[model samples]
Target: MNLVTQLPVSGAAPKLLDFPAPTVSGLPTPALRGKPVPPAQRVYFYSPDEWEVFITEWASGLSYRQIKQLGGSGDRGVDVAAFKTDNGLEGAWDCFQAKHYNRSLNFSDAFPEMLKILHGVVAGFYCRPDRYVFVAPQGCGSTLDRLLSRPKELQKKFLEDLNKSSAATRHYPKQTLNSIREYAQSIDFSIFQSLQLSEMIETHRKTPYFAARFGTALPERTVVKETPVTPSPDEAVYVKKLLDVYNEQDPACCSDVDSLSVHTTYGKQFQRQRESFYSAEALRLYARDSVPDGTYELLQKDVYTGVIDTAEANHPSGLDRLRAVLTQSGQLDLSAHTLISVSTLEDRQGICHQLANADKLTWVDTNE
Candidate 1:
């Protein structure tokens, strides 16, 4: 029941579509928000590559450093793959297929992906993903969207379309066709779904790093959805080591892991990690929103830039300097800018030195 089999006939893979180069400006507004001119309308402006990156990061709740793009020749139809761990088993994968078609996406756009996924499943190219998403800027056409909503209708339609006598399947060798027919009967149609660029933009608007990505104002805490992440085995071990080190440094400082977690530096890092976990958890609530790819890195760069500008200008401290710059530019709410974690003045100052050493003090102004 979990398997999906509405597949295309096998053939040499089609060339990748020619997507327009991505840019931050000049994004088209989507029809859905035409008159009202909704916030985040620029989402419709993203290149397919940009959309794919955003989808991977936002949906997976992975930090910018963790996501990997796999779109290209030999990608096997999957544009992005996000690695996740849950329940200690690890490897909970989600696959995103990006279709950057200029026109509204129709069955033809989806069929080859279906074929690739079905054939991949049979051949074990990858494990059955927890979610298999079809991402596009224009979104799905009426028929496909309707079918996606009603699984049985989708199953019936797919089978009928790929019937033995249908031209779509006529070219498949008999053995392949027979195999596909058998597979189609048992494939699960529910895994197939679509997301529109506009919806994704709306979702991204509420993320913590949204302002950094689009140069829009940050959402208030009330609207800032949190994303939570599962502690991988490695991360868990690292946390344990941090706590253990704290205990060794000052036995009087902590009696157990819980107590050690309260130490200044370690505690702050732990809290940040906990925030990340919650942010990941929040991602599920905004399944359609994806932080545009590289948003986090951009935020990091901006924060660093703010820090340096403040230091050079003789601002009170790195923390105060960064906050003043971001707040003045209207990109941050000084009362609650949780985009980066710095528990103390020392931590803030240390970050400035680190960024300075790396020679990466260039910050983008909200105006820019």
Candidate 2:
């Protein structure tokens, strides 16, 4: 059965730990195992506030200029709003109404929220949103889903329900409710829709917040294959440092990149070092998109901590010190870091250059 069909519609929602352990089918070969719970199933356990926050995070990934969460009291029916311009609701915008409940959302649970928007528009709280979306963990009930699929029927149902005397919408002023009927009648109900739980989860997967929120593994990092033949402006500091290292070994060995490129031995070393630098650069770029901020910086800190003593100790030559520090960096136990899985050997070695680029490490003793 599908994951949603396995959920309970009443009582307390099931926790992640409550699910049965994966089963291994009996076989001589490796056994087949059950799949982990999908994000769609896990979302049912989030509190109402958390649901709105998730909607906010998801909305931020869309092409909106800004996303704001207005979920608490006096929010005027908007939970999370995505704006296309700085003018906010005055400009084109989309409203995501977060509905968290023990069961799927039905017409009764959604109509009041719908009225709030209509009322808000007529009351000058804000203009009608370009689109209105219902975000619920358990999705919509069969009746609500059917109405949403048919725009004209959904609009007709809203008008019919607006005329009925019900406590659900009683707080709306009589005059306001009467005025909203005309505005509601004109609303293109096609703009009112439900966000599918699976769609939200899939789209959220592309965002940096996904792995942290859903406890999912990050997407695999692509390898950086090419390093520039000529050094770029950003590589100036480290390249100069390498030149200093080569010159320290033998004063006339190399003066600059053009001179170093033809060196019989150090030329090969320079090429390898450049490749490693670019590999680490690739990791930095990948981490910026896949994980939270400072993750790559933390990795750099760990690498520096691993090699600082080796970098400080006396060496036979600057080349020896550079080699020893790089060796120590590769041996570091960085299993605690999030990027460790995708980090390559070149990336570890290249981070030493990144440190040098920041003037954190120096090969030759300047005091000498």
Per-candidate alpha-carbon RMSD to the true structure: 12.3, 10.2
Give per-residue CA lDDT, model 1, range 1-368, as digits (tens): 33333443244432333232223321222224335434445556777666675675455344322344663587766776655654211246666788876777787677767766656554445555666788877788998888888877887877776664654565456666566556767768888888766666666555533544555433432343442334445345334433443444466865555665667655565455345433433332322243333433344454564544444575433334444543443332222332333223332333332343344432322122
| lDDT against the true structure, each candidate | 0.52, 0.79
Off by over 4 Å in 2: 1-35, 313-317, 365-368
Candidate 2: tens digits of C-alpha lDDT, residues 65-107? 8777663377777877788999887779998888999889999
Best candidate according to TM-score: 2
| lDDT leader | 2
Query: What's the true lDDT of residue 171 in model 1?
Result: 48
Each candidate's number of clashing pairs is: 12, 0
Error (Å) of candidate 2 at residue 196 is 1.3
